[model samples]
Target: MQGTVDSTPVVTGHEVAAHEEHQDLRVLGLITFLASEFLMFAGFFAVFLVFRGSHVQWPPEETEVELLLPAVNTLILVSSSWVINLGTKAIKKNDLAGMRKWFGITAAMGAIFLAGQVYEYMNLGYGLKTNLFSNCFYLTTGFHGAHVFIGLVLILGVLWRSRRANHYNDITHTGPEMAEIYWHFVDVVWIVLFSLIYLLTLI
Candidate 1:
């Protein structure tokens, strides 16, 4: 008696290799984009350092940048970076629920940091046109805040997609991976910004 064959197709090694190659290309493209972004920020940093070096008083008399709120925000972002990594680890283990939890925490942290930034702005007792330092300070922090907002949106988009069936698994988690990378970039940029604009200037 001839046995019946299952006839179901399985994913081939070549297909897996091709998918990995595509993912690598996507990551490479993201890195190139981030490099350009870093260059732009570098330009702003140079301008800020030049202004700070030239002026006797870094922030001037009228501008007052407090340390408490920005320090808290920095802590929130730095911790969120770790949380997003946990999400990455979860997805690598094929744990969808775990990934969602960690990413949700990260998004909440990002929201809190943004709210803190807004509160800081309201109480800062200065404006963009106040002086050279104020202008540089606002421009640099505002640009970084915009990136944070974008990162939040990206995270939310990934969460929404994760609700779909089989949208992401251990082998097919590129969306979350890319979002994590962007979030990490945003966090790193803030660390640099905090060190320069807040820590060095205020304390």
Candidate 2:
């Protein structure tokens, strides 16, 4: 009689290679999307700069853009970037608990940052129609807030998926990786925007 054969199915090396290649393509797609996003934001920045250049006063003589709240919001976003990285690392290590904790914090921080933005909008002494600077300010920052909201949604989705067994592992974590990339992009773009819109005015 023939010896009993083991019945477990095995993953082929070719299958693994193909999965990696697909993951690479997904990452490349995200990068391309972000490139387009950057161009759009650059256009907004150019418009703001044009308006600033033509006027003797940047935000106009009467309008004052507050700094304290935005500074706090900046800190929140920067911290969230770090937190999300921790989550990405945790998922890579197959530590779902750590990933959940860190990503949860990151999502909370993002929500707080967005709330702060809305509060700032409520308190700003001018309206979008008040002047060109005000218009650019609302447009650019509001666009960024929309991105933050999307990032938060993405994080929550990742967290939900993380609930599944073996959903993400060292070699299978494209979702967390992509979400991390997008969140970092959001943070970096915000840093540039904050410097240009808030810090530059102080000089």
Candidate 3:
């Protein structure tokens, strides 16, 4: 029997190879960028430590800055990182529903943490210009809050895109994964900031 048979789909080898190469380049670029960010933050931490050690009485003797609020915010941020990890894991498993739910929770927690920061600022007796302690506290925690805001934006973008394009699959979930990486970094920074700036008050 004479029959015309089409053996394969029409995608060219060059196209497939190009796509893989592009993905590899993207991952490498992200890692490089994050490394640079870590170095910059490390310098800030060094400065903070020097100034913190020089001060005999932190926040001065007259000012009253409660340590409990920032500690609570630290816990919230850390828990949000766990939620984000769950979302990323779900996306890798091709569980879109779970990913959305967990990501939403993570976003909410992050928002709550930011709100707590604002509340703490309101309650802080001294403004950023008042003293070295106030300046350092504001600089470190404010920088961390900005990072949290950016992370929330990234999470929202992924959630919207995942819904629109159904883009996250077992083989392609880099967006959520990268977002989780960034979120975890933010959480870790807060842990250090909280311990250095807040918990140290106890000792």
Highest lDDT model number:
2
List of clashing residue pairs for candidate 3: none
Model 2 RMSD to the real structure?
Answer: 8.2
Tens digits of per-residue lDDT for model 1, 1-203: 26988755565676775665423477778878998998888899989989889989888878868898788889899999999999989999999999999999999999999999999888988888988988999999999999999999999999999999879899989889999999999998998888888888755
Residue pairs of candidate 1 with colliding backbone atoms: none
lDDT of 3 by residue, 1-203 (tens): 34868656555787785665433456566677878877766777788788868877765776656777877877888888889999988988889999999999999999999999899899776788987777777888888889899989999998888886679987888888888888987887788877787777777
Task: Estimate, for each residue in 1-203, the C-alpha lDDT of model 2 and write its tens digit.
Answer: 36989755556676775665422588889999999999999999898888888888888876778999999999999999999999989988888899899999999999999999999999987888897788899999999999999999999999999899989888888999999999999998999999999998998
Relative to the true structure, how large is the alpha-carbon lDDT of every model? 0.90, 0.91, 0.82
Query: Which has the higher TM-score value, candidate number 1 or candidate number 3?
Result: 1
TM-score of each: 0.88, 0.88, 0.86
Off by over 4 Å in 2: 1-23
Candidates sorted by lDDT, descending order?
A: 2, 1, 3
lDDT of 2 at 170: 83
Q: Which sections of candidate 1 miss by over 4 Å?
A: 1-24
